[model samples]
Target: MSREFEFAQLLRAYRKGILSEKAFEEEMTRLEGGACGGFIAMGKTYASERDAIVAYLQRVRNGEAAGARALEQWAQVCKTDCMRSGLRTIAEREAYHVRVIDRKLNDLGARCEPAADPEIDRFVSMQSDPNISDLDKLRRITSSFANADEVVKPIYEFVDLIKQDLDAKEMLALWAEDEYSSIKWFLHACAALGGAAQSPADSRHEAMASAQTH
Candidate 1:
């Protein structure tokens, strides 16, 4: 690839969180001044881009698996028609993510390791409780994320980093968008129910609310 193209890719990777500030600077220096160096590892924990992508996929798979369970239970108990519908849709989506990630991990010749998460378990319990109001559950969900970007930033950053595994990259891109959509819907639902956050547009509310009757 041309040095200019490589430079643009490096810039994109840095912006996406694939490359650290230090690594980006180093690559920039190399490209700009024709300095000789090897490829620097991407993350603090992983040795290469594949390692980072695999690790990230593992983490996301675990979280999404747990979230799928919690959302399934929550949907069962959710009293609000609109919120319940959305919860079911999101639950299925999370479950699908787990399946796809698992397949990707298997294709990469990696073992699927189950990691224990106590906080996720607690959240599942709270979500499944029939006594808790839907609005309260919405608040609990939205409160965990400081903002919409907080929900999908890691996914997008990780997606931007992958160079060779186009399949995984594309899946992650869709996964990030799905996550973003779910969070936005939750935030809007929370706000529409008289929560403190700003409500989404009437059209969004209408679209989600329509799901209840279908």
Candidate 2:
């Protein structure tokens, strides 16, 4: 059968309750053959939801650390206004978020073998390019966040599915809040720099709220 047909069959099985939700998601992961998002993005599904969450946590830490390190490097090369103190603060938060999440994963007896994402390297190169103006950088950042609704969807999915562990869920929520704050800071800065009519935070918040309802 074609891959598309196979996926349709899998969806039918899931909808009919022939497979448990976890099993359905795992099968989807297998079909995906790589990370898309959520607990499965660590590239495997555990026998238990808790274990799966631990794996997700490990991946989250690595992604956050990569972003943080890149942000710090960019800050060093940025012009004074571009660095803007806000950049440093967000970088610090991202760094600490990595450490905190890693500790949480280890506390659950999970070993983390994190992988670096090349996207971060590309982002750093883009930011550090002397040929690009900071106005252009601001625009790029705001434009990339056009899918603000889906940006943190994976985190919410993991939290909602985790029943036995409230701590992890709460931690993820707090992390989401920080992410929202960071985005707002950037957007507000963009507005200050003669860009955007509405505050980026206000517009994105509506998108995020809509995402949560769905």
Best by TM-score: 1
| lDDT (10s digit) by residue, model 2, range 1-214 | 3447768998999899898899988877765652343234344656655768776777677768866876676677666453447778989999999888878887788767866567866776787676776656667778777534466676676677764477887998889878877877667655555556654456553453343335
Candidate 1 residue-wise lDDT, 1-214, digit = tens: 4567888899999999999999999878866543343323334545445666677787778889888998999888887776777789999999999999899888878856888889888988998999988778888988878778887887777777666568888999999889998898788887767665454557666565555347
* Lowest-sum lDDT 10-residue window in model 1: 34-43
Candidate 1, residue 154: the lDDT equals 72
Poorest lDDT segment (10 consecutive residues) of candidate 2: 34-43
User: How large is the C-alpha RMSD of every model relative to the true structure?
Assistant: 8.0, 12.0
Q: What is the C-alpha lDDT of each candidate?
A: 0.78, 0.69
Q: Positional deviation of 4 in candidate 1, in angstroms?
A: 22
Clashing pairs in 2: none
